[model samples]
Target chain A: MSWARPLVLGRLVRLAWLLPLAAVGLFTLISLAPIDPVQAYVGDRTALVGSDQRAAIAAAWGLDRPATERFGAWLGGVAQGDLGRSITYDAPVSEVIARRVPASLALIGTAFVTSFVVGTGLGIAAATARGGVGDRILRSLAVVLSASPGFWIAILLIAVFAIALGWLPSCCAAPPGLTLAEVGIGDRLRHLVLPVATLSVVGTAPLILHTRQRLVVFLDGPAAQHLRAHGLTERRIAFGAGLRHAVGPALNLHLAGAGELFGGSVLAETVFAWPGLGQATARAATGADAPLLMGIGLSTLLLVFCGNLAADIAARIADPRLRHPRP
Target chain B: MTLRARDVGLSFAHPGTHPDHAPTRALEGISFDVAPGEVLGIAGSSGAGKSLIAAALAGILPPAALLDGGITLNGTPPSPRDIALAPQRLDALDPLATLGRQIRRLGGRRTDPAALLARVGLTARVARAYPHSLSGGMARRALLATALAGGAAWVVVDEPTVGLDPEAADRVMALLRALAEEGRGLVVISHDLPRLARIATRVLVLQDGRAVETAPAAAFAGDGTGLATAFARRLWQAQIEDPAC
Candidate 1:
């Protein structure tokens, strides 16, 4: 547990630098886009607005300023705990993010937990049956699922369960034009099913493949042999000694893959029209909502940093060698 | 009852990583026996298949290795649990487990971890340490202790004293000797022929995975005069005259 202290402090230091760097990077990338923020905000009314009105709008939003000046203003506001405002939504960036974060968390949290549990189980099964039919089938499934794009799978699920069978809604976190107060719990969960399943399938693939690969090596290693020699059955050795040995590497692999999982969630959100940070990010990127994008970018960097740190702490708990220095 | 490897042979697939590979013979025509209260020492230079023989005896051969003939106890194939192998590689110990927990797991709930560690000349504190925290010598002793704790009828120990200081090495040899004296069969594999000769009832010398000689321990006498094979004589002489000695 002592390892957690230094590990967390070190990550916090890295994160302090990462948040600003990510904000600047997102601001720069979004700035390079051809879409005009005022044009996006006004939509088809862009032609109706006169040059005078456009100039007033650009001045009001500070879009008329130099990129460096706008970035400096944004950074200064962030240092003072202000996240600026979303030009697209006509709301504070922080407020928009707060409203959307729970939706994203519900989606990513359910999907990620499912992926971890199911992927780890499948991986253990495959490794325990390495070179057998079950191993081959699981490995093949992992390959196909991992290689396919997340949105593609989302569309496929929508096609089968939503459009084809009409078993579930095709898209969106709630029925069109419905407020949170109007939607029932069952309806909300019904709307969630496809996207969560899609993200879970996408996230689970790499975990299964990685866990199986790492665990197979461990199952064939000296520790497994030692366990076998001690009179334990194969099943006992695989679940007992082999699982403990392989889990640390598998967890680290999963955490190292946080970037991909985040990227996949974005794709899933766009396809399913989920009202989450990912969907907001997509809309913000296209609408040239610099402030909103900056807020989301910083939040994402923070989430990923926290996730990796949590994984490090968990792995140390699993393997004591990681907790103490080699004597 | 005795532990026996009768005409036992082992061949691992070459280019082991590949699906299509040829079997490369590692050990063949290897035969020996260790009855209760007897110690059989297996000695050879590096790459002589000494460890392979130990793996064969313990029934922990790699999946790629094709084993021929048989290793038996009391005239039948023994269950894997009946043989305890303390592998040469320190990595064989469960890295995630404390020495005490692993001892309890292998030795059963009733077996006292501290008592077992003390028997191997380790402190009770050592039982609480993870494998990686131990020195190489400590790891080796810990491994031996775990093997002993298994309480297997047949114990196969590979290079049990490779990293130990002289005194610790002697202590390990004595502990193994005591096990044999207590009517447990042991197959002690080592490059330290001299130390092995001290306790081994019979020493089987291996060359390129084949047994070159199986002689009574007393045969490794002055100037290696009693050693039967010329190769065995030179091997004995070389160890005796080595600069390390």
Candidate 2:
């Protein structure tokens, strides 16, 4: 080929099914949930409402239609950028998400960056130093944290920082005060501290493990052995060839783990009462707001799809072997 | 400068020795010398110490191995500046780099990828390709380029023709001959005795990690009668007896 093909186009084509498949799965599971959004919307008046009134409400909401029809209609509305109105917020689902996007962006973005930097750094250090005390400690810590659930860590942090020490608020994104822009950096940072930490503490473990594993393969493998025989210092060969070879696999694992990280955002956001899609998702579920729940589910699935695409593109950029479609 | 191994012996930790970790000898009574312009071939069967000796000469023996006798490149201990080893594996090529980029990196101050590829019997077009895209012969030559990148005076090539076709193997052997002609000491470890004999000035026979016989390449002649030891002769006899095997 005289001109190099756009690998991203090929990657996207390969990955195009991820979003639709995940949407179907999410819609199916949500539909199967035993939530009575109509009954929840009616509240205490369920006792007083006549059967005809109830039937009218159900039919109006298209709940009287077959599940396949309802899902199809909802999916069609989603394609038109209408995520339906929230029964709980008494507003458009998009508006509720819009009001909360900044909080999610600020929190998840910080978590995403912090987890990668710290995790990869620790992993490199541990691998290079192999049997050192630091590696031993970090490896054990990674094992424990990888298995630890997100909410458990959040609750633990709350117990220590908020209850026992009384140093920070137990919940909520910020103290009841002026808007976020008006709040000083110190106040904003304090509000950010717990949730970001909660996500990071649990999130960084898999990255560290994956990076270390890849580094070991690169450093200890036959290729490394061959490099050493070429009269270069161990440190130079390791930093040069080792890092270059390890980056592709390590980044792949990191990206794969990143998709699932959104799940943790839900627990982290709820624990701190941060007004993100995470917390909104929980509240929607609790209120049995089917439309709002579906909207949040779709958004989270889209984020995962984007993350996977980003990783594939990133891999292509970093390594030429991944650039072209495999023959 | 001559590369010499004087009664070189290596041992490794063995719990069989008792409560105290005593080393068990893996290689013993190994000795040889290769001068500039000489191609010294080492031959051995499976589980013999051929690759280990290659690694030791390049100062890359496993950490558990302990050395008794010294190895000297130009009367100093073996170091990367004077010695290089091209191992069997080609996957060691950095997958992230283009052939030219990797060649340049390995070449250090000798940074002309086009020149290096030409020297290794490859065209400049080969430089633009990734390691995986290169054919088996091209990859081997590229690795040879990497091994010679630092311009080491002595090169140890372990199983350089392991997976090559006859034509590619001939090309690699010819390249080794050309390098030897350039006055660099070369050591080749291989099971292919006929190929080694075609280029090697002298061949060192090894069995069970010990030097069995040191013979001029011409001595591996008809019926193996010219060989110095029965073990070396028997090995040749086996190959001659069962050429299909």
Candidate 3:
């Protein structure tokens, strides 16, 4: 606990640098894209807007300025808590993110929690059943699931559950005409099923494999042998000492996989047309919306940093030696 | 009644090989006896199958291992409650658990963890400490305390003095001697014969995977004339004559 302050400060310090790095990197990549911001803004009416009006639009959004100057000004604005405005949404970047945050959180959080709990349980079961038919079956299933792509899985689920049986909706977080408050819990959840299942299955595979691997090695390890020799039953040894040793690494692997989880979310969101940050990211990337994309990129970086920090804290809690090391 | 091993043999199926492959005989015709209030030392060079014998006695051998012969106490195979094995490595203690928790895990509902730690010469605070905070000697004593927690009649300790300084090694030897004096059967295994001789009531010498000699601890004293087997004599000679020893 005394280590908490320093750990938080250390992570914050890293974030201070990483935010700018991501912004600059995204800015450079956006600038390089073969896209005209004006063309994207005018959309289907590009020919009708005329060059003079196009020049006016570019000037209005500061796209006429040099990339370095724009980046410097954006960085300055970010330092003062302004994330600039989204050219695509015609709103502040922060406001746009705020509007979408809940939808994204709902989907991502549900998927993440589902994967974690189910995967951990499966891992413990497979490890305890080591070398048996159950172990082989679970391991084989995990390997196959891990090898499959998240988008493909999402598409397949949509095909069977949504298209053929017509048991669920195939696209969007809500029906096409619905607004945020108009959607019922059942409606939201019904819409959530396929995307959540896809993310959970993909996320769960690595955890099952990692947890099983660590626990198997632990159960066969010296500490466990010592416990086994001391009259503790196999059941106690596997769940007690074996689980204690395996959990820290499993939590670590799962949490540090935030990037992969987010990456999978993008794919999951795109396939299901879920209105989350992943969909926003796809929109921003496609339109080459510099400010909006920069805002999303910074948010993703912050999310990853937070995940890693949580991982460090979790590891310290799980293993006391990390929290209080003896010289 | 005594703990007895009559012609105990062990062979491991050569790993990752065809079923028809010949098994490797790691230990053959190993035999010994220890009664309550006795310290029987098993000694040999490194890889002398001393640990294999310990594993077999503790019934913790891997599935690939095939054991032949009986290890019984009072004319019956000892239950896990009747015997415990303390492995050689310090890593044998659960790194994540406090010493007290691990001790209580094995001690069951009837035994007190603090009392067990006290018996092993560790303070109550040591029980609260994790394994990583412990020194080499302290970890060894903690392992001893954990073994004692189960209230077993017999304790098999492997290389208790392997990584200790002479002072610490002496203290551990005294602890083992104390356990024996409390009427517990002790099977102490080590490569360090001279140190083991101080507390061992009888010594069983092994070479390559076979027992070379079994003699009273007194036979290891003086100039080795009392040792019956030539191999035991040379072992004693090597320990006494080597300056680095």
Chain A TM-score vs. truth, each candidate: 0.94, 0.86, 0.94
Model 1, runs deviating above 4 Å: A324-327, B9-31, B63-70, B208-210
Q: Mark the regions of model 2 whose C-alpha exceeds 4 Å error after superposition.
A: A1-28, A38-76, A163-170, A318-327, B15-22, B237-245
By summed lDDT, the worst window of 10 consecutive residues in model 3 chain B runs over: B236-245
Residue A235 deviation, candidate 1, in Å? 1.0
- Winning candidate number (DockQ): 3
Q: Model 2 Cα displacement at A223 (Å)?
A: 1.1
- Model 1, A1-327: lDDT tens digits are 568889888888988787767777888898898999888877888679988998899999999999999999988998899999998789999999999999999888888778888888898889999999999999999999988877788889989999999999978888999976799999999988998899888668878888888788877888887887776888988887788766777777676667667777888899988889889989998889999988888888888887788788877887887786556
Better of 1 and 3 by TM-score: 3
Task: Give per-residue CA lDDT, model 1, range B1-245, as digits (tens).
Answer: 98988998888776636766568889989999999999999998889999988777777777778999878888999887788888998999888889998898887889899998987789999988888888887888899889988788788999998878778788789989998898889999998888899999999999998999999999987788999899888888988887653
- What's the lDDT for candidate 1? 0.86
- Tell me how far the alpha carbon of residue A199 in candidate 3 is from the true structure, in angstroms, after superposition: 2.0
Instruction: Classify candidate 2 by CAPRI docking class.
Output: medium
Q: Give DockQ per model, in order.
A: 0.71, 0.66, 0.80
- lDDT by residue (A75-101, candidate 3, tens digit) is 889889999998878899999999888
